[model samples]
Target: MHSIGLIGGTFDRFHAGHHSLLLAGLEKCQKLEVWMTSDRLVQAKDSRILSWDERAAELLNFIGEDLSSSLSINSLEDNVGPAPTHSEAGAIICTSETRANCEEINLQRQKNGLGVLEIIQAEYVEAHDGKPISSSRIRAGEIDSEGNSWIPKNSRQGVITLTKEIESKLKDPFGILCEGPEDDLSVAILGALEVAGDGASPIIGVGDVTILGLQLVGINADIGLIDEKTQRQKWHGYDDINQSNFDNILNCINPPGKLTPSLLDACEIAMVNYHNDESTLIIVDGEEDLAPLFLHPLAPIGSVVLYGQPHRGVVLRLTGIDSKTRCRRLLNAFSSE
Candidate 1:
């Protein structure tokens, strides 16, 4: 009879590292058993594992239908899994990080009078940054399955605020200007209130009235930038806005007509949350009128940023290569402080 082998893991994203470990396990035994840890166990570790069925399908596809016949897949209810109980299993496969668990399984086997299985430890897979490949790092968006960066660190570096010396260049408008509330400007911008030109593009409302107006027109902004005031007047309904259904609410201090470091950090936090499909609100202590200073350049391509045009109405700026270039030039026009 073929010697039965055991392997246990969360197998969360099932990347190249997982493939290496499984291949090594398959080479060590004619028949291999994979114990995909239960949802509770995975949650205890990271709380964000892919569903069990998805992980199982990925493992089976990696093993191939022909080799899968000799593979036994089961849910591991506890850390020990079936390794201590499987009488005929003669080997356990794991990475160096999990080797201690294998040793504990063998100790349990000794207590139960079962034979100690050989432990096979797989080498760690390193990313382009020379860090160990892990599911948490994948979820954090540090690297892809092949360990390549989605975007280089320097490419996403934060924007620096410009000094006040070049205020002359900032007076001109960059996008189409509308002259009314959400419903009025919605028609002017050609369905921009609900979504951008692309239906799935995220809308970021950068002023108090802009956010409320978008909601008035049945368009919920993915990210809202509000300072609890309208046109420099203390808005009456701060309590109501505080009760809105935002997944996260953050505060930043940015005085009128200037982009501060705190404002940049808050914008980055909101953008990250938006990419993760979470609704976020940036509650500003001072003026949020000039938020487009950072919002236009920082938002993802295809995103739409709406800010109040004062007494005029709302202005819609589509984020793209051209828009970012214009915003950068305008920002650089200001004196570097």
Candidate 2:
């Protein structure tokens, strides 16, 4: 009987390491069946590298029509159930990290009266720096000098393009000045709203910019609004509040006590009452307010705030404070800009 091999993954973009593994598996098995994860499963796995259609198309392109004719490519995860199992193939090819999962698969096969499965473990390719190269690592922008060499020439350009795009989107406008601990929320909201207002341009600040960029993409926005008042309202009432007194006064005034006591209780008192006397006019503008709020203790008022405006734009802002000084510093920075 001819032996068949089964391989599965998101395969967002087929790389040389993947090509080598498939070829190695085909050499050992008479035929190879490639199972692509379903779109839903891909999302569940947090494999946002690409859309399901894009991933499938790329895989088909990589395998080509000739080899793909013999290779079965289907989204088993979508057809079957959650965490779908593979059929009783002759063997399954997987990486060392997923070896345990392969074992579990074989055990399931055994229970189903299918004989033991042959497991093919592919050796991990390392970059020049001896660091293991993986799709996740590459996606995370960790491609070092050694890792770049191991990448296939054909795929390198695409990877570079993707990396550049992500980097561009993640750039911070305020440069390294946005790195201050207290300025995180202000920086994130400002950056996101700016992108939503603009045409997906890059900014410079810190990781907050990247976080806001991701949020904007979810809303399909090009730019966002900034509502300093609304942002302040939300933060003043939240617990573990640690912002400047000036920010607190701004939050209290802009939304004009729009904050709920429960929220304030959750955020603690210092953030709400710190700067009761400061004169600050909260600015309300942008579309970032449409996005869902990621609640957290001492979280910047508008740190996770987003507003989506159809055919217009999104707005975001910052509110609340742990200290009056920090809030003033952030506002000063904004004014200076």
Candidate 3:
């Protein structure tokens, strides 16, 4: 008989205690087979159950790259069999909380003409506050409140990594447009609204023309308008232009910088500027030309187009390209209020 150990769970949140149990089981058995509960079974058992596909994905993510090489996961309850039994497995590993189900599983295996197998039970892990570490507890938003260290260092890092991957997948890289210093903001605004719609967010960097363009569309976003004269006068001791007419004062208050450079130079900036703040649309307007600006030291890796709009108002010209056609198809998925 193969030394296969079966582990089952809804794995809604895939916490650290679950990971520790899997590691311990794997060490005792030659091969580890993770039986993720089906969505229907999970819904029937737990109040806040994740979908089968999502549960599997979370399990795979939690296992990480190294351990995944030695383990396999499946939603067996939703598969051909009517829930997996210990007869098919060398041993079944369960937490003390679920140990009572072991007898029921064994009986079902016997009825199916398979002999009973060993049942391995692991002790429940305690949180910092003396409460049991559980998915339900974490999902209820009581982990931090109860002072429960539910998120281990590795699991916390894994969650961040998974979140970033999901965010990147959702973002449309081609939707971004890089406008040069000489390029008119009016033209860019028209182009962006034409291409991405009025919902697009425009991030105006240090420039006079770009800020004017943003105001024309009634779009208010952060503008990184630096008071060059005042800054020079105060810092460099050269008082030329009046403080009121300084370039920064004339431009928008927040002078937006290149997303790529800002992301690469500072960790906090990168996480805040580029990560999915889906509510706010981002358009970068900088001093450098569009093509070269996109070629900045920290530009994101993807193919982007630089174009100019001759007209003032938004132009919705349909491109014959297949990608653009797909984009239109995707746009139709969203319903306008």
Candidate 4:
């Protein structure tokens, strides 16, 4: 009698962790049934997920022909899929986080007069920081497929400086600054929203004025980093963004010209917390001027990061490879400490 196994995941941006999980299932059962979450289901969780075809191909390539021949890969439209209902599936495989779901599936199976499945748990593949490697981290550009760090963690070593040359080159990447009358700024924000669409991507605001302006335009940011000052003057414009609005509120000291390791960790935590559809606020004690350096790499692809441009209006940066490369180049230009 062949022992059958079951495992399910979005498998977006597949990595070493996923490989470990799948191999665990293959080791325990002769035939392993893999359920890849559908695109709709993935999008319901996060817009940054890779397409279903892309995810499937990546998994197939890694698993190879021998295992692929024994594997029955199906697109999962629902959470439980066929895990609890399949008669031949005697074992279920998952990581620690998904172990509870496997047990829940067993409970449902018991109710349906089906036998309970043996739950095989796979150990998590951790990154350099010892955190479990996840697709979200990969999409954020924090880690690669094998759980290797991509962005340097020693961002707090030196102060950031915006000399005349740096300022001139970065004056306009997206467009001309929109410093303006209330109506004009509002119009500009609305136009940006039109391009981005409402609730299509996470809005990350980097400064107090930019956050307040987004609030005024009726767009509450998914993540906000503010220092309570504009043009080096004390600003109390964040009254609208009360603590009650965010699921997680963090306070970190990332001096004006430097992006600290703490700031990067905070942003990563904020992104994970924001998964519940609630907002996150990072209140900076010092300057948040250099936040783009971290945000460019930490933000999900297609998310918009908003920051003020001194006298100019808000500058919106859509997170992507180009933006991340630009941020990296600017950081390299900074005088080494």
Pick the lDDT winner: 4
Estimate every model's Cα lDDT from 0 to 1: 0.73, 0.43, 0.45, 0.77
What is candidate 1's lDDT per residue for 117-168, written digit by digit as tens? 9998888889988988877666544455666544323223433344555556
Residue-level lDDT of model 2, residues 124-196, one tens digit each, is: 7775557776666544333421255311233212211123333343233211121212323444345545534
- Candidate 4 or 2, higher TM-score: 4
Compose the digit string of candidate 4's lDDT tens values, residues 66-94: 77887888999999999878887899999
- Model 4 misses residue 158 by how many Å? 4.2
Which runs of model 3 end up more than 4 angstroms from their true locations?
44-48, 76-88, 144-337
Q: Go through the candidates in order and give the C-alpha RMSD of each one to the true structure.
A: 10.1, 16.0, 15.2, 6.0
Instruction: Answer with 2 or 4, whichever has the higher lDDT.
Output: 4
Top-TM-score candidate index = 4
Q: Candidates 1 and 2: which is better by lDDT?
A: 1
TM-score of each: 0.52, 0.45, 0.41, 0.63
What are the runs in model 4 whose C-alpha is more than 4 Å off?
Answer: 1-4, 28-31, 40-51, 61-72, 83-91, 99-119, 135-151, 158-183, 200-202, 206-289, 300-302, 308-315, 320-335
lDDT accuracy of residue 204 in candidate 3 = 31
TM-score of 3: 0.41
Ranking by TM-score: 4, 1, 2, 3
**Backbone N/Cα/C clashes per model:** 2, 60, 8, 2
List the pairs of residues colliding in candidate 3: 201-281, 203-283, 223-254, 223-255, 224-254, 224-255, 224-256, 225-255
CA shift of 293, model 2, Å: 32
